[model samples]
Target chain A: MVERALLLCLLLIGFWGVVAKKNIIKKIFGLNILNAAAVMLFILEGNRIGSEAPILESGLAQVVDPIPQALMLTAIVIGVCVTALALALAVHLYQITGSFDIETIRERIQDET
Target chain B: MGKRKAWSPTLQACLAIGAMGVVLLPVFLSQTPWPTVARDYLMQYGQDESGARNLVSAIYLGYRAFDTLGETIVLLVAVIGTMGLLSRVESLVNTVGDDDNTIQTVSAFSLRGDKRSSHVLRTHLLEVVTGKIGPIVLLFGFYVMLYGHLSPGGGFQGGVIIASGIVFLALGNQQDNTSALSKSSILGGIESVSFLLFIIVAMSGIFFGKGFFGNPLADSAYPVGFIVLLNSIIGLKVGASIGFMCIAMMGGHD
Candidate 1:
């Protein structure tokens, strides 16, 4: 329960970073943080049922749920892909506007028109 | 100023945080117990069914293989999008470099020195270390990828490691004998070829009447062979795509 509380705080922190940060790079960091929190939360929840890792060996006790771990694998991969795409977009924006700040970029774009 | 800053940024942050908390409170507070049905069933027959000692591997590479296919497709698309945007940025930079006044020109830097210790670019010592360690990391990545059925690591983990190795190789390209794997064209070719091979293997299961992504070797003594093959294919695809993206991001324009 305490762990879940901590993860919620982490989620909120990441959300705040995304919402409040003016820099596009910082926003990408926030997204990665948010993704990390969600992944950790899912793995934690899935771990509630057992004490062992999902790898099977002879005479081993009950293992934790592999389903959530498996699902989280996909989530983590997608998160990486999303982060790469986001960073690429950020770089492109920087090249275009010569600024990392979202507000500055927007203002510059507006001026270009 | 249009509105004289009517609402403070802090107030807006507070509102967003409060709304987010309201939305997520239920999820964090939920007391519903984790179900055990699937876990129990997987424990009982996962090894026998998939020939994988690792149940996680069994689930992803066995039951939910189509999902893995989709994940790979997503990775491919992300790489494609990144490379596309990157090429545009490259061309933009090149056009800017047409003017002699632009100090950011690639040619301008190369003419400065044989060992370019640019503001944030590589150092000689770092290059040497990364170049030495890169191939070993790649070897370990293949090891983990091949033995994933019985171990903790899998295609995704090993593939990420392999990407790091490729990044290392690219970073250490000041030396001879390092240009081959770091070449964007070769990396792109590897990614495309592996994706094709993945589809071919996936379709091979159909000819064996094992349905889509079904283990064609299920009846054989090496049912886990299918998992191993899939892991390698996935590892190659992931590593190549990510490596290509990283190389491009590092301004390996070719």
Candidate 2:
């Protein structure tokens, strides 16, 4: 129960970081944090009361849901691609305008327009 | 000033409603027993399709190979689009020629200036492991792709695992090997090979009177293994394509 609450709290913190971070690079890092928190929450949620192995065997004990674990693997891959792309975009944007700050970039774009 | 005054009341109302929606969503979600529903569904229909003990892998690769294909396309498209956007063929090469620019800048220098670093990792253990274990993992990922039909893994997972191995080189040997490693022609070769292989697999159904992307080889003797084989092919394509894409983007970026 306490673990569940802590997971939720960390998820919220991750969300806050994505929303509140000023630097575009930091925002990408925040997004990665948020993704990690979501994956952790999923794994935590799928835990059985006393499941033994994710690999289903015949007669030992209850097994946890391997679905979320498998899905989370997909999610992790997609997350990596997303983070890489975001960071790439950030790097390119910085190269263009010479600023990592989101507000500064927005202002520069506005000036250009 | 007029726009600010005009938007204030509407914005306040939207914020209040949005906050309420966020608060109420979890409350509504908690009342349902979704996991039990999923489990019961899996127990009924998941086993035969997925040969492995892990039912999740079965659903992902077996029951939902179509969706996985679509997901692979998304990653592929992202890599291609990034390459189109960032391939600074002329200026990037010129930038790489500078000797003074190679120093690692730990502080905020001029924003317009690009810094190149030839800093090697000080850790001896990392050098040994990355040199040895990295290529082995990449080769193993291909094995995972080939054997996904009989085992607990598939193409997407194996492909990403292989990409992770490639990332080690990028981090370890973070020099201007981008152009040398990520040649556009090489990426084209990898992409076309996978795309052609996928089309051939799908078209085999037409030639052999099986359904689209159907296993012509599967019969009562060992019907399911062919689908797993298809999964592996898809996995190999996706994994190699992504690995090459990441290297290409990293290499091309100035």
Candidate 3:
């Protein structure tokens, strides 16, 4: 229950970051935090009673679910890719506009028109 | 200062909070547990069937190889997109030269101001340390990749490790002279070849009478070899692709 609450709190914080922040970099970081929270939630859900690592060891009875871990591994890599792409786009945006502030960029665009 | 707001910040925050609450309500209320049928089957026969003692490896390389292939493609697409975008800026800078001051300022920011004096003792120490540790980190990455089936680490982890080592080397080297280590073309070549090899191996399984990406060696006593091969290929592909991406992205900055 505590873990679930913590995960939810993290998700909410990330949501706040994404919604409230104007800086593009902060938005990217919020996206990352959101990804991390989801990954952790999946891993946490896979935890079982008397569960052990999925490695085949002698006389081991219960092993935690490996499927989630495998899927989450893919998710983590995809997250990295997304972060990289977003940062590259941010760099391009920064190049076009002198500032990272979204409002400033918007005003600059309007003035140009 | 009196611009009309699309929606008040409080209203947006309340909407966000409400949406989050609605989304999480079901998860908090019900405890529909994960089905154990697949997990049980995997735990029982995973080793004998997939020849990987680590069940996660079996799932990743054997049962779900198709998913892994798709994931690699996703990574490839992302790298290509980033490089394409960055290359446009490079060409723009090259064509414009110093005519536009704004472009000059943009390029300067993008370059990250690595204009440090080379004779600085602190810079020399950093260079020496990164130069020494780089090879060791790379070797360790290979070890993790090769031993993935038996250990916790896998191609993705090892590949990231290797890329970080390359990044360290790239960062330590002076900006004016390109480092011997930062060969983007060579890294790109390795990435393409390894991805092709991975696909070829996957296709070979189909031709060998095993289903697509099926373990042809499952009939043999040591089916782990196939998993190991896939792991190595994945490691090389990921490491090269990430390393190339890093080099390409930083290439402009330097």
DockQ for each model: 0.74, 0.32, 0.59
For candidate 3, write residues B1-254 as lDDT tens digits.
56776878778887987798689867743578777888899988999989988888999999999889999999999889888777756533443345532424333322433433322232567767876787889899998888889988888888888887876676555444555556777778888999999998888788769978988787887999899999999998888878877776654332
Candidate 2 or 1, higher TM-score: 1
The worst-scoring run of ten residues by lDDT in candidate 3 chain B lies at: B101-110
Better of 2 and 3 by lDDT: 3
Residue pairs in candidate 2 whose N, alpha carbon or C atoms collide under 3 angstroms = B149-B228, B155-B235, B159-B239, B178-B251
lDDT top scorer: 1
In terms of TM-score, which candidate is strongest? Answer: 1
Q: Which TM-score value belongs to model 1?
A: 0.92
TM-score of chain B of each: 0.88, 0.67, 0.81
lDDT of 3 at B192: 90
Order of models, best TM-score first: 1, 3, 2
Query: Model 2 reproduces what portion of true contacts?
Result: 0.22
Ten residues in sequence with the least summed lDDT for candidate 1 chain B: B106-115
TM-score of each: 0.92, 0.74, 0.88
Candidate 2 residue lDDT tens string, B75-116: 767666666655632243333334544642211111121333
| Model number 2 iRMSD | 5.2
